[model samples]
Target chain A: MKQVLPKADTERAIDSVFAAARGRMPGAGLVPQIRARAFEVYERTGLPHRGMEDWKYTDLRALIGEVLPLAPRPNAEALVRAKVSAEQVSADQAVKLVLVDGVFAPELSDLGRLENEVVVRSLREVLENSATEAIAGLVLSTTNDSAISLNAAMATDGLVITVADGNAVKRPIQIVHVATGLSVSTFTRSYLQLGKGAHAAIVESFVPAEGASGYQANDAIIALVGDEASLSHIRVAADASDAVNISSAIIAVGARAKLDLFSMTCSGSISRYQGFITLAGEGTKLSANGVNLIRDKLRADTTIVVDHAGPHCTSREKFRAVVDDCGRSVFQGRIVVRPAARKTDATLTTRALLLSDQAEADNKPELKILADDVTCGHGATSGALDDTLVFYLRARGLSEKDAQMLLIKAFFGESIEEITSEKLRDFVTAQAEHWLQAGR
Target chain B: MALLEIRDLRVGVEDREVIRGLDLNVNAGEVHAIMGPNGSGKSTLSHVIAGKPGYEITGGQILFRGENLLRMEPNERAAKGVFLAFQYPIEIPGVTTMNFLRAALNAQRKARDQQEFSTPEFLKRVRDVADSLNIPQDMLKRGVNVGFSGGEKKRNEILQMALFEPSLCILDEIDSGLDIDALRIVASGINALRSPKRAMIVITHYRRLLDHIEPEIVHVMSKGRVMKSGGKELALELEACGYAQFEDAA
Candidate 1:
């Protein structure tokens, strides 16, 4: 294997990662070859900079600064001490899967009582056994996206979940990722395949273990929903304050399939959550919503792209960002309808609230419709809280802080109420309240 | 001492003077009505008294129970037994009425060095007050004034007044959007809270509301200062004679 000396810090960081993972990296046959190809692509592009349209608001080159070597695989002691945080927003009946430091931990996971129609396997195990055709192809191998390419090149371990046709999972499945060590970089890639007519709900959470700091985590999740399948996906990233988290979700919806995706980001010094969704068949429905509660020097970015390729599909995207103190928040949503996709109904709305004078919020909603008969619209709003409303509450006897708090809660109340799951809604609400109370 | 004393008060909104040299005195047991044509600084007086922001008191003294009222913030005034029923109550979409009231009540209590009410005790008190004001329980459960009718918002304002039990209450244009039935209900709600230890300043444009909740003093204001001070019959006399004469007087 020829070693490629790279120039940029992000690229040099990748070379070091490849050097460190010598022969122990997962995968065999086409998997290793695919990883090498991904590395080649990543080396060619380096890290996405400020010029890239998709990376405009989130400049990884500048934001990431210097990427460290891949986190040495968690040791037995580290795994033993790692526990899912108490912020699990799942019901008691949920089937939980735990990933420590980007590696699937079977001891922490409960797979014994999984439904007969569902099959869950470790991604690394599947890759090492040459049984990677289905999982490998199911994953969206981004050729140009440097982040996902880097994720693929350094992918450590994650889950491969398959739901059989027409089987509805009675309990929700939670994939909780707990970062246990400090000053380490972790990459995880997961693939979920839902057969025709299958229905399931999956929750993914990223939270660092107690006192962990300066961890960099990159995660890519690819899901393929078959025709008539319904999937509810919720992702929450509550990392340590000094952590850098970059998460991406790539979903493909088939004919008549429904995808309800929601994400909430609460802590993290620098974070970006992006979603790439495609409605491929007719009669598909997509609702993608997000809420970000960020304070201090945190910079949170949420970008979503919904591609409507089939006629008569409906899609709605809503995002709310609350930036406090010196925090900066960004929301970018784009809905694209192809020329043949007539009768498409797509609406995108993004709103941001700036809490302090130094706080900043940037919202951009775009619509590209080549179909003449399609109904597509986008709206964006960014401003400070209404002074009159604050005065109204204060005049009613609420203190200044309490008045502001009440208005902030009400601002997020409408969007949080849109969550389909009761427990998840409560969890998001509590996280938002936590952010509100974390003031300057 | 008078409950409220406004001595030659001068107030301005932005670059224009709104309330110029306004003087009024209200005893502990008095209901005063200030009426005039549009833009007569009636709302200005109410807002300045309640300490709403954006008002510059260039000259004057406003003393509440012998304490300088201008030095207090809006919430400080509220905690110090002052309430203002906004003519156009702002709709807060997320904070439920129940939550708002409890927080308000507890804030006042806390400022007064009183123990906060427990959840059950607060709910019982709110239910009792809400029942008397004809406020449905579900309305209290919903967001404050969100999607409320015009009359419902007015009633909610009165409900806040009832719950807070302020010593000096200022109702600004409280009769603007009420129908006959809602007016009667609101008037009775105000009448129920009237006591010798409390005073109210009702700013209205019509004589109908004055008829339901009769005022002890009526002052005709024009431009900024009061042009005439008389009894409750003055409201009816002004209603018949119109405020053209007062507008000229200013």
Candidate 2:
């Protein structure tokens, strides 16, 4: 295939976003530095598409082909109110950080009980209010990826959740980064920092606000699990039928740390979620599972990279997808074990269920082990529901629909059961069953 | 009074018929053993009676409690007191035995318009049933039939039958892959479930299971048909003769 330039419409759109990003910068401590660096990278990389290796199966070309940022609408307040209220998990239960249309909605949000051990602040506000040293060392130092830099430059207001050493937030934190009505392009940069011995479970759910369309949401969530800290991040997305949601999460699990990431992509037009986790310390453990349900010619891609960089570290990754009605789902999971990472046990498995003959699921589970003492394996499987099992269920007096629903429920529940929270567990299970009922 | 009446039953899987015009009946409080060689349709009789799919009922009438049992779906039959101890039980991962058993029991109960049981009440009931079958309560917490030994799987099946408490139980080779101790335990469980109102059909290749749970009638099946029917002595005669009479029917 020939390398095609950005579509004329998209180029104009990107240029307009760059001009707006440069013009919209509010002078602050770290803003000027990050914004300058972001613009440098933005000019170099432009917007990555299917041609890039990491974006190979994603084909973001369809999403980026039309460059537009949804303009902030008049009903932004109402949309933000509904977004937080509509969360399946109660706002009272989550350490809620509500971002409305790329800016923190303070009046509509609740950040409760934060002492020295915990800190809940906004990215833009953090930059404006942080001590100069903290702004330079902490805020401006971490983001190395081009996407994060790009997001940092254009992001208006974002979340900054920090935990001091040996502190664990009792309740799971819920960060709802919602893009409300009509945006041409939106950039979001959020960060989660856990110090040593800290633990937290965070759920980041992004649902397109009602009637939001014709836009690109370039999202970057950077999570750092410090030594002896354990964190679980659950990402859920329900994109509008016409909207394109592109998000990436880069997580680094430090020495003896643990990170568990679970993601479910329910409804989307073209969505790409990439997870990059670095098992940085000996005895560190990392596990990631993604369940993607796609329909109506929609395409959802989940790409994960797990690196066992420390000795005695463990990594497990599993991806399951249900594709139907000409929908396309792609899962590319890679587990890497270094030569020094002895006793590193890593496994990757991708199981896909194709509901329609025209629907397709492509899974590539790859393992690259440079250590001889490591135990690593990878497997990819694609199949329909077992006829024998279906017959067995129907024989027991279940209708065809009921039997398939039960089986698909059981099939998807295998991973959902691994979720630690019972409340979230039941909610996701019911959601999965509901999706099955919709036959999507 | 006959609790179960199978008249002119003809069944086939795919295109080939397996149960060829087989007729059998059982009165309340009676236990009947259907013995046959491999492919003799002993299993098919149990599955077909339970309404398993893929098997066409070209000609058959199964009357249970004066109702057309063949017309009922499998779970309906189960709800109406029909249980089949599977020859090969399914392995359901991530689903605990207790969870699935509770669901099955509750499903049956719901069909009967019974109130649902609380978790504690269900556990208490399950414990008693498990203890009687020599099954550990911990087994219920494990995934359904996953990684259980052959004997353990069969015992789990009987445990389910015991818990469900169906009217006319069908044991399809419950003794097939069992050790002596397992076979005795299985037969004892069946014996424990026997009631005057609850009849049973024990399908097997050997008569060893009948030793513990005595059957009132024994029938030798060959080529999808019952060739001989007699008392317990029939098992002894078949054991002595080694199925020489079965070759004539083929």
- Computed on alpha carbons, the lDDT of every model, listed in order, comes to 0.86, 0.77
What digit string (tens of lDDT, one per residue) describes model 2 on residues B52-155? 77788899798998899878877788778888888888877666888778777887788899997999998988999899988987888998888899989999
Error of 2 at B170 (Å): 1.0
> Alpha carbon lDDT of residue A104, candidate 1?
90
lDDT string for model 1 (A53-157, tens) is: 988988888888678777777787777656636235444567888888888988877788687878998888888885566556555276478888888888888
In candidate 1, what are the lDDT values of residues B54-138, reduced to their tens digit? 9989999999999999998888899999999999998888788898899899999998899999999989888998899899999
- Tens-place lDDT digits, model 2, residues A145-228: 455556666766667889988998877777776666564666666778999999888887776655566556667787889999
Which regions in candidate 1 have their CA more than 4 angstroms from the true location? A1-7, A84-93, A112-117, B113-138
lDDT of 2 at A136: 35
Return the top candidate by TM-score: 1
Q: Pick the candidate with the highest DockQ.
A: 1
Stretches of model 2 off by over 4 angstroms after superposition: A1-8, A25-46, A63-65, A73-92, A113-116, A127-150, A210-215, A390-403, A421-427, A433-440
